[model samples]
Target: MTKFNTTAGKPPIVVSDEDYGRLTKLATAALDRFPDVAEELQIEMERAQVLSTATIPEGVVQMGSTVEYHSDVEQRRRITLVYPGEADIAEGRVSILTPIGAALIGLSAGQSIRWVSRDGREHVLTVLKVEQPVASATPTVV
Candidate 1:
């Protein structure tokens, strides 16, 4: 099996501590049902540079961030990284448990990574843009 590579010299990835904690639990629970994906998620978490949610860079691909990426075969795609429950392919929402989603987490704009899909095909994805979710303002009671 030709596994994904995070070999030396690749660009570093930054993940928020909140995301890390939640994703860790998700991966652990998926170990029995989705071993390959769980393993990949674990590997990503192992190499991630974890930061606090407030400290994470705006351009980094975090959960719920909308990202525009260029793939070697698929060309350009705009996808929102979301948890499994919120994933909807028709709406361009990708699940964190999927191959592409697992590969995209923590990556920053302008970084490119090569990952193999479930069908054993390798694809190179380059992040073109990252749109972080806007923080909701606190409601004030008059």
Candidate 2:
């Protein structure tokens, strides 16, 4: 069994202003269609670890993650967990609001998460490795 860090007393995750706005709208709309789901989302938001381009954990992939998953649907997918307005299906950049994206959040290499798509299809995704993105060495002239 993998021992994931127990998230206790950790500050709630933060969302970008843009992302928060979209989430707020979605939450409001869901209040009528899926009240329980909306509430659960609220909880996730409260416990979320907010990060900007900076808060992205080192050695962890944020949006624009190109990883290989081995599951019932074994295939190489360049998955991206982006917010609305940032999602590009053409590039395989899935929105964080999507089912697969929701399951992939916070997962690291060797970790597997079971997910059911919106169509009720079940699948498991195991993160094999994350390609390190090249960081610009030049310091910004602030």
Q: Could you say which candidate leads in TM-score?
A: 1
- Misplaced by over 4 Å in model 1 are 5-9, 136-142
For model 2, what is the alpha-carbon lDDT of residue 132? 41
lDDT of 1 by residue, 74-114 (tens): 77999999888888999999998998999999999999988
Clashing pairs in 1: none
> What's the lDDT for residue 44 in model 2?
46
**Candidate 1 residue 63 C-alpha distance from true site, Å:** 0.2
RMSD list, candidates in order: 4.5, 7.9
- Residue lDDT tens for model 2, 76-110: 66665655457788987776556566555455667
What's each prediction's TM-score?
0.90, 0.56
